[model samples]
Target: MTYWSGFCSLQKEVQPIELTKRQEMILQIVKDEGPITGEQIAEKLNLTRATLRPDLAILTMSGFLDARPRVGYFYAGKSGNQLLGEHVRKLSVKDYKSVPVVVKEETSVYDAICTMFLEDVGTLFVVKEGGILIGVVSRKDLLKSSMGNQDLQTIPVGVIMTRMPNIVRCTLEDSLSEAAAKLIRYQVDALPVVKEAENGGGLEVVGRITKTTITRAFVELGEEATV
Candidate 1:
């Protein structure tokens, strides 16, 4: 819950940094005369280095310029779209993951379906004791099981779930771009975000990354860009 809150807060914080006129001038000067020192830039603008510090800082922080220790500042040469792509690629699965909807292996298919509907999630991570992930159950899995003659209340989800080694999953360190790619390549609606358990047990289910999750991210990015 705390993590999801933090993620929402982060999305709200991505306001567009509007460049000042002098900041625009600084960029043009760097573009025309790059590999140029900060002192040189100030000299060209007929301003003191101290007076231009904040503008330089803003440009650098906003990805409009890159600064070197001795070599000085240069144009980053990234368009707004490119910068947006770079930002999206840098998003970590851990940062954006939503709390996973989970079920135990022994959980009945009926109960699993109920949980899925109540939680409003398309996929459920099947975990053993200690939250160790064992398998994944999707909407299709439940639908298929429900169509069978077998009793839904009696059959355990473990019987129908796509078990580990067959499950396509992601780790905390994984980039969101990788998670999105896996979703496309596997044609799965969601991927469990997992991590190695401290007790050397197995991959522990931490959170979830879904098609909706990725879509939300893009939507948030669009909102930020337009802000």
Candidate 2:
């Protein structure tokens, strides 16, 4: 994509990137040379291409340079901070929440464990017949239950899960920062993303936020910045 094309876009955003002096110099070199090859840039600066390859890679990946196969790299004229600020300040939970893993409130503890492992999730949201949020169960919750000889296959997860009116959750409107705090403040790894039920009933589980979700968001943001 062109450099100006990214100006109006957040590029999904990223944290401010700090550039070393040499990296800045390399960017300046590319700016002056215009659509120059990495070998030419390095040779012009009296350095081997191998010596400067990492800086070139960093510049291209962080939005300062654009590279094309066999065409070398060109200055993209984008700032790392400018690209990153948009995502952190403007993006909300709705963009990052993952599909929620849910099971019926009446589901057996054994079944919930199987579902958790099958879905590869850290936490499971227990819902009513209509997918209304009712409770939450984590790996720890299952482990505690499993440690005992209580009938896991017959015992309901609703009995061991953290019941509603107490579950830590976020709405679609909540910011990513707020979701991160909910994870930290509650000392939990995940939060059920919820929305208010019809009229004045209760929350309906919509999605989920987890450490993995945040990590994946940053990974994608970095990828977008590069593109």
Question: In terms of lDDT, which candidate is strongest?
Answer: 1
lDDT of each: 0.88, 0.83
Clashing pairs in 2: 14-84
| Model 2 misplaced stretches (Cα beyond 4 Å) | 1-83
Q: Model 1 has how many clashing residue pairs?
A: 0
Query: Model 1 Cα RMSD, Å?
Result: 16.6
lDDT of 1 at 170: 95
TM-score of each: 0.70, 0.62
Pick the TM-score winner.
1
